[model samples]
Target: MRNNLISGLIFSFFLGMSWLTKADLYDATLAYQNEEFTLAFSKFSRLAQLGNADAMYNLGVMYLYGQGTEQSAANAFAWFSLAKEFGIAEAFQTAQLVLQQSNDQSGLKDFLKLQKSRLSNTYLLDSTLTKLKQHSTTPTLSKTHDVLPEYPDEAVRQGIEGWVWLEFDIDQSGKATNIEVIDSYPRHVFTASLLNAVEKWRYTGSKQAHTLIYHFATHKDEQYRETLAIQKKAYEKQLRQNIDAAERGVAQVQYYIANWLSMKEYNAYQLLRYHWRSDEPMNELYLAAAKNGLDLAQYRLATQLINAGAHQLGVLWLEHAAQTMDIAKYRLATVLLNTGEPQDVPHALQVLIEASNNGHLRATLLLVNTYLTRLSDKAQAKAWLRHGLIIDPEHPELLLLLARLAENQAEAKKLASQALKSASQRNWSSHAIHLFLQKLAN
Candidate 1:
């Protein structure tokens, strides 16, 4: 928990909307004042998702100050802008202040604008709020007694580490029953132990099925070191092969080695085992692959460059990759749109349309948002929404957007209900659909 409240006025600012009960707001504020940053953040997030304008403001402040979560000027601005839309008068000033204090002010503003576009989408906001309200009433199942599997001696001797994914149901008396091993790495090595342990497990009975993954990792003792030695030998052998392939101008292998070099494991193991390479050459590996015309490598390198603030160069690489990659087109469109330059808007829309035509969901959604919010072309937005629905009729986002744009109340409710039915597939949210439907019924 970080004690970066900025001022006492933040507490008073939490009173903006009536969606949250006074007691809930008080508890969240009290948690923050007591330096229980994580708890405060969780509570405020739940409240904010449920359309509590004040909670949105509090989340913005917390994000700006890195109170319970990572400090993010972009997130702070987004939440503040959302709160402003909900009638929090101070949110605009707070958003501007966050932008002013940001290290990369120009880039921060673009990212913040992107966030605002997302948060301000009425279809998205309603879905989020409705889902939160619904989830609030759902009963949470918890383990009453926990059990861990004892690692098999044979597994230890073989120096094998694996995981088992188990699916089971809880009986009325809170005991585990009907246990089935869904999948396991290294086959049946750990299955018997896992089954035996899970048989004794207890939970607060919900009669609902649940899935759990139990990982068996050997401790970093003598056995683990032996396993590591074996793995390192194999890794070195493969590394030599990959290096040979990379040197022969195999673009895919070059990218693979570059990706491996970028991993934390490579850094940790390189100091211990690989004395042949350093950080700088590994960093250039992606550049080499990109130069060799690996589209994926080009996209990856472009992302790195953009994040590092080399926007012009990144956009150029993105354009090259976008000629063949739908995802790259979407990324290029995002960057172009974020620039907020008049000349960039048409190019952004063009690429987004190209990506959307290829059935890229995110690109389609962005296109709809751009047409609706930026271009103020409701007919184009609706047309794209319809196109998106054709791609994935059950997609909750597209359905929700259609629901919000429906010409009549009955049509709106039907679309919304359809969105709610398919929401579980998207893991979008819960509970709000019921509340929203109830509101519609009344």
Candidate 2:
């Protein structure tokens, strides 16, 4: 019996050794790290479909970098989620980062819920187990041996299809514990489904907290995928055209593209500030465009400079742009207002008055607020508002301001009602006006 046991152990050891190595997977990983992304992507994708966790993780990275496929945050997220479940140790962290870069938390949550729903508890692939068995450091799903939930009868009866967010903790023993709901529309319906599934879900790793989504639906989620594909293709084509036009100096394209690049940089600041490096400087584009006397470019450059604390240079740009652009004059007034002197106030107010006279509603509103606060001048506020009313009488915000100036309570109420009704009908309620109306109501 002892000799037979020893022989069995030796056979298992040889089997494990044979199963562990894959020349194609190793080559793919090497290529990925060496920045031969296209070649790496092909190999990794092929292996990922074979249920290789490492290949799945690499595929996620490739998608994130736009190496072989179109740069798709959604695809990256999906691949990483698969990798994480299949026992890739670092895939979870990478997936979270990919989602953050996508800049759509609500949409991502929905996507994840749908993904979770599509995954079957009974669906353990032999290939995934083979890959996972080779990496002992990687965590395994807790072998709790639980059943996957069936489609709820109530869900079908009322045509109810939605998602629920669930939070759970993996304990020191690699068991999923303390499951609870975070958010769900029509809460009680999906709670049982989540709780029952989680009861048998386990993880074999260090303690970790996770929030997952479970979405219910009647049909395949092909519509959203199709829409995203169309948008991505359109954006890419437009981007290439814009880049060509900007480089060739095709009329207003230079300034327009420069301004767009500036906005992109601003949006990316938080994400790229710490570690992500970029050689593309939108400042050079802005400078070139401003030198060519692009009024919009000058204004944007001035705003950028002011934000970076270069006040004197920014003011010059603002002043130059303000010579032709009414909006620039309004923005110049805003910059001048921070100069900390009584003389600056008069000049700023004058610039604002000019902009307001030129049909800038925001400038007019700012003038109204300033006049009402500084000089307590009801006449000036009325005059400023009248200019906007001439342009657009049914402008809900201006109507709301007029209500604030009403002589009697009944007049105020009538004006307020008119503005609210108009705003509701038109979907044009600005946050500033909304807050002001709320305050006046209180």
Clashing pairs in 2: 142-202, 142-203
Candidate 2 regions exceeding 4 Å error are 1-251, 256-281, 338-340, 426-442
> Which runs of model 1 end up more than 4 angstroms from their true locations?
1-234, 266-278, 430-442
TM-score of each: 0.47, 0.39
Best by lDDT: 1
Query: What are the candidates' C-alpha RMSDs?
Result: 22.5, 26.3
Residues 39-108, candidate 2, lDDT per residue (tens digit)?
8888777555434555666666667668878987777788777877866555676677667666786776
Cα deviation at 134, candidate 2, in Å, is 49
Could you tell me which 10 consecutive residues in candidate 1 have the lowest summed lDDT? 123-132
